[model samples]
Target: MGHWWDRNIIEPGKLPLLLALAAFVLTFLITRVVTRLIRAGKGPFGNVTAGSVHIHHVVPGVVLTVIGGFGAVASGRHGFGPALSAVIFGIGTGLVLDEFALILHLDDVYWSEAGRKSVEMVVLTAALVGLLLAGFVPFGVNDLSEDELQNRAGAVVSIGVNFLFALIALSKGKARTAVFGVIIPVVALIGSLRLARPGSLWARRFYRRRPRARARAVLRAYHHDRRWAGPRRAFGDWLGGKPDPPHPLERD
Candidate 1:
């Protein structure tokens, strides 16, 4: 185990990344537990406020993030300082992403349906970081042979091709595929070659003139949503807690 760790993590200078990932996941889980307890009115935890203005955790998160980010930059990739900075940055990231929906909408929507965006962002972030921890270099460069990488032209072409495929996947609304394709080109290639989702940028621009293609896209999207929406919602609720139901006054 120690030999494997040395070869995979220590030798690669990823100890700080490992610490950060651990801290980030733990912070997020702890924050959710405390918040859920508060919502149930079963804990000592409560919202922080100053007079009439509520102070969100994101405030501290921003401060810590700045300090830790700078500290990491100054300290480089080794020693206790870098490790501590990574932990701080990860904690701050966890807190900030916990309220991502609030930041995005510039409103207190943490308990609303819109709040699910936070969960999705956090999950995506964790997955990407996990992939990095697993030694997946971005843009499929890790898969290139040493000889190919040594050739500047070949390397550029490989990276450019993979990135273009990822962009195409994104335009087709395959966000997850596009993101993961940075590490696995085949994923993006598959997504880029598939039918675009309904209402996606690709669909809007290209499918406008093709009724059959539009119809197929819509049908595929409907089936995809129908098959996955329930499980997705359930997963989000399990991790982030179910969103508060709409009040009668807000209901149509």
Candidate 2:
């Protein structure tokens, strides 16, 4: 284990990245706990207000992100400075992303269904970072042999092809597949081979004339959502508190 750590993490100067990932996850968890407590009116935590203005945590988050981002660049990756900077940046990122819905909608949406987007984004970010920490390189570049890597034309072609696959997956509206496909080309290839989402650009452009294909896409999407939606919502609510019940007028 120690040897693996030295070979994979220490040698590659990934300690800071590891620190950042830890800090990001911990910060999000802690923030959720505090917010949940505040919502329930059962904790010492309360909203920060100055006169009539409400001060969101994202304010300080942006500040910390700037300081830590520049500090990390200046500090380089070799020393304690980089590690500390990573932690700071991670904390800022957590705070900022925690209210990502507010930034997206230009309004406070915490505790609303829209707020769940923040949780999804945070989870996605953490998962991607975790994959990198697990030694998955983007675009399958790491899978090339020393000879192939040395062949500039071959390397470029490989990367370009993989990137094209990722792009196709994205066009199909398989975003998660596209993201993971960048790290593993096979994943992207699979997504590219699959039917596009019904409302996606790929479907609109290609499936429009193919009534059978369009019908299949819609059916697949319905089944897929039905299968996963419940579990996904449960997981999100477990991480961040459940959203408030819909208002009467908003109810379908």
Computed on alpha carbons, the lDDT of every model, listed in order, comes to: 0.93, 0.93
lDDT value, candidate 2, whole model: 0.93
Quote the positional error of residue 43 for candidate 2 in Å.
Answer: 1.3
Query: Which lDDT value does model 1 have at 42?
Result: 89
TM-score to true structure, per model:
0.97, 0.97
C-alpha RMSD of each candidate structure in angstroms: 1.0, 1.2
Task: Mark the regions of model 1 whose C-alpha exceeds 4 Å error after superposition.
Answer: none
State the weakest 10-residue window (summed lDDT) of model 2: 75-84
Scored by Cα lDDT, where does model 1 land? 0.93
Local accuracy of candidate 1 as per-residue lDDT tens digits, 85-128: 99999999999999999999999999899999999999999999
Q: Report clashes for each candidate as comma-separated counts.
A: 1, 0
Candidate 2 lDDT, tens digit per residue, 36-102?
9999999799999999999998898898889889989999756689999999999999999999999
TM-score of candidate 2 on Cα atoms, chains taken together: 0.97
Query: Which parts of model 2 have CA positions greater than 4 angstroms off?
Result: none
